[model samples]
Target: MARYVTGAPPPSLDPAVVALLEKAETATIGHWRHWGFVDRRVAPLLPRRRVAGTAFTVMLPANDGTMLAHALDHLRPGDVLVVDRLGDRRHACIGGGLAVAAQAAGAVAAVVDGPCTDLEEIEEAGFPVWCRGLAPVTTQIFDMGGAMNVPVSIGGAVVMPGDAVICDNSGVLVLPPGEAEAEARRAIETQARGAETARRVAAGELRMGVVSGATARVTGG
Candidate 1:
């Protein structure tokens, strides 16, 4: 029932990985597709808790327990289960059982760009799942999907196996491998600058001078 390969590297490096991290500040998964991450139309089928973990991608069409079981065994703590259903929201490829298995193996959460079932069961397990839709139908184990340890596309963005995935109430964001340090630093600095501006605003800092330049920088005016 395995559809893809795991442990094997991707054919080539994704050119978009670099730019994806560059635009990390504004990248979000919502209305627009191909922002800075994959557009897995996933809803939290399990729980509404926050999810932060390294991504382990699975490609559908050639995947099954043989591959998933191995992937689970190999995955370390702080990992997120990323499954690419090839944009197919027809059936529930993953559900509660898989969530339980993944959690037992130390998975932080799961992200599926396809349909998912067993919402109640998953929620009870306290596993965070972001999926496209909900359904009881599952794949026929046709070896169509596989567990690939390479970069795979879900929604519209490419997710490398080791990238960091952060999901919250706002939306989901993917950070390319090794880019977390720099991105986090920049985000912190920008947030500090914003906080300072907020303080000034409370102290009567008007748009005449203080806020005008900042506005221009953000708006290109």
Candidate 2:
């Protein structure tokens, strides 16, 4: 047996705020010591792609996917679906059809705590998905019920609906709505500094360790 929990609609991230986050990489943001990142194993299905949007979280029961379809109705363009599989990594509750539906609904990406099926079709649909791994075993509509738009844990981080979700080849990070704007601004500045350092290095004016201050920190000089 399962239960479906419903509540008021969660807030959405402003498009400008989403754009700010999209400008920075997860690794850069994580460097600031934000711990909302999902596990490294949950990585993008394609290489060199990134996703930044508000989270639309779902909590599914083990081996059942009754609520996923219902969840799609709430998606908006630039929304990232974060699925918590209730620690059942064995079952892949998402597949090609769901991916298509998500894309059609304007979801930018999906992050699943468990495995996923239909990698080929998901890729074909150009829907970016992050998951533990690939599995031929898929879940069914058990009608057992699940939860949506609630706080759920994925990859050790509590992701609530409306939280900012940033994903790339590096990994996924969940930013609380309250912190998203400030953190994005910080990450943008860091990215600019990094770009300058890279340029200096390319011009043979700076060494990697020297530019990063690692040499000075270690040599004590």
Candidate 3:
């Protein structure tokens, strides 16, 4: 027997907090020592787009997509749908129609641990999606049971509803709501420092080896 768990609605993060994270790169967020990055194989359908929002998680069975309908209804503006396909990489559980539905529901993006279909339609809809890849084969409406708004594992990272989700060209990462603001601050500082270092290097005021202290360390000078 399958189960459906509609947990409490996740709390939305402050808009300011979301904005801070949206400006930071996914790579910087991944350095927070948390297990939040989805697999590299799961990549964006459209290039150079970034999405940051609260997570609305979904868990699906191997060949069933019945619960996706329910998950769609739970979406809120600025929510990112994080779907866990339970290690079934064979069948695509989302496609063009589903992507459109999600967008209509105000979902900022969709990140799936499994494959997706109808690449052309998805791209045409302008809905950002990160998934294992494209597959002509799709899941059937088996009415098999699944869960919504529950913790799910995607690409070895456990995602909970309301967790901060950031997706970009680098990959997808989920941050605990409590840690998002602090981590965003750290990433911002890091980005600023990197930019200044690059500027100095470009002007010949500093060298890569001097900036990184690698030359002296390696040569024991």
Candidate 4:
């Protein structure tokens, strides 16, 4: 059996906010739809937590909740465990107990493209988890799943060990290898500008001036 390891630490940032904006909003996801790296269906089950670093993905034959339990034994701090339950909604791949273990093992967060159990427990532990929904049903480990970093699909995105995954209240976003640093800079700036515009609107600024001017520049009008 081979073990997975990150060659180096990821770019430094506040984990909470990093996870918050890492998601490609519906619009951005549409923009990257052709890139084949977006997961459009997963929803956040708990509050946002920063997620960065190489993706450490595990593919389970089904929703065997114990995969995270086993994987935590080797998961290092700052790792993002991406779990695939073969797109099964019959059971949850993660729940409260596993959330605590993953956090204790130093994982940044967990993203399950299937269901999850122990919603209250996960929230109590303060470990961020994003999943499709909640379900108490679970699959036995005997079915299938692997650890120590691997590539797997979530929604429609193919995530590899060590690739960047950004999740927020908006949605989940994957940053391809060698793209995190630059993309993060651009994302942060775009988000900040958006926030500023929102504030101005709250103070009664008209979109005709700010938004229209930007639209015209892009349209070359």
Candidate 5:
């Protein structure tokens, strides 16, 4: 087989769509959808930061980072590099250099199915990465066959190049472009409603159980 298998970069999501999705928290979305969430094992390096963007995906070989460079080369603004490590959680293919490179290419963030290294450099670069964890061992440009801009799995979530990637402290969520807009809109409305409920409780106009419906359910009133 060829040393590398790749495809053209998928179309990017509209910036307006991205803006809408960014404000919609994954936890809020979780209340409605049963799927499309990345495994909890994969988490954010900076939990406080939230980002939304188009998925620019790559299937990286277990210990080879050759395809990563290609993926970076093609990354456009507002893209998130979603890496499938082929189940190699031991070796980290992403580190300081790749983080900086991808950020310079206008990537909003990256999601990896495995570990990553160079924590100091990555933090210094101020890039957000959702990954398994930190590792001392790293991958190399071994030229093993890999693919870019194609469908891949991250944390058991199937991600495509054009998918909508929303990530934050909670976890990473991938959604089809068409579905993303509606989901984000719903989540936003739900968040507003939730906030209003919290406000009433804080104002002493309602109790916690009353807000949650537990009071009625328990009292049968």
Candidate 6:
């Protein structure tokens, strides 16, 4: 196999769609969706801000970060670097320098299937990252085999280059391009309705169970 295999980067997503998707919280989308969620293990460093972007998938071999470094150059504005660690969890591929590079290149966030280093740097850089966790050990520029712009696995989710990515405090959600707009629109509407329901409940005008049909179910039972 070639030491480094790369494919054409996926087309950038529409800014309008990304904006719409960003407004939809992952938690709200989770209510109606059961699939496409990244594994719970891949947690975020900065979870307060929500972001939506296109998936820029990369797969790396153990102890190698050559492809990742190269991938940074290819990142477009609003791209989310989706790293497939290929089962190596200890070697960190992302750090302070890469964070800045990605930021300058217009990457909104990253999702790593493994650990990363330089927690303090990442925090100071204000770069958002989601990964297995942190590690002291890191990857070197080994010319090990790797792939870019291809379908890769991250935290139990199948992510393809150019797939829609919705990330928030709750977690990361990947969806096919065709489903992003409709699903995001649904989530936004649901959240709006949920707010009104909460408002009524808070005003003592309604009960939680009643709004959710739980009261009727229990009463009939």
The alpha-carbon root-mean-square deviation between model 1 and the true structure, to one decimal in Å, is 6.3
| Best model number under lDDT | 6
Look at candidate 4 and tell me the lDDT of residue 208.
Answer: 46
Candidate 5 local lDDT, 22-61, one digit each (tens): 9999999999798999999899876557899999989987
Ranking by lDDT: 6, 5, 3, 2, 4, 1
Off by over 4 Å in 4: 1-38, 63-67, 143-148, 199-206, 213-221
lDDT per residue for candidate 2 within 1-221, as digits (tens), equals 56798655577899999889888788998886768988898887778476699898898987888888888887888889899999988889889999999999999999999999998899899899999988888788888888988899998998988899988899999989999999989999999999998999999998999877899999996
lDDT of 5: 0.91
Query: Sort by TM-score, best first: what order?
Result: 6, 5, 3, 2, 4, 1
Q: Model 5: runs farther than 4 Å from truth? A: none
C-alpha lDDT (0 to 100) for residue 2 of candidate 2: 67
Output the better candidate (1/6) by TM-score: 6
lDDT of 3 by residue, 1-221 (tens): 66777788799889999999888898876665557777788898779567799999998998899898777987999999989999999999889999999999999899999899999999899999999988888888787889888999989888999999989899988889999898888999998998999999999999999779899999998
For each predicted model, how many residue pairs clash, with residues at least 3 apart or on different chains?
25, 0, 0, 8, 0, 0
TM-scores for all candidates: the values are 0.72, 0.95, 0.95, 0.75, 0.96, 0.97
Check candidate 2 and list the clashing pairs. Answer: none
Question: lDDT tens string, model 4, 1-221?
Answer: 33332223334344553454454343344343455344555777865744454466776666454455666677777677788777688888677778888888887788887888898899899888778888878766553434446567888888767677776666677767566655666656666777788888778875745674986787777
Whole-structure CA lDDT of model 2: 0.88
1-221, model 6: which lDDT tens digit per residue?
A: 44787999898889999999999998898998999999988889766588999999999999999999999999999999999999998899999999999999999999999998898899999999999889999999878889999999988899989999988888999999989999999999999999999999999999999878998999994
42: Cα error in model 4, Å: 1.0
Stretches off by above 4 angstroms in model 6 are none
**Model 5 — which ten-residue stretch has the worst lDDT?**
1-10
TM-score, candidate 6, is 0.97
Off by over 4 Å in 3: 31-34
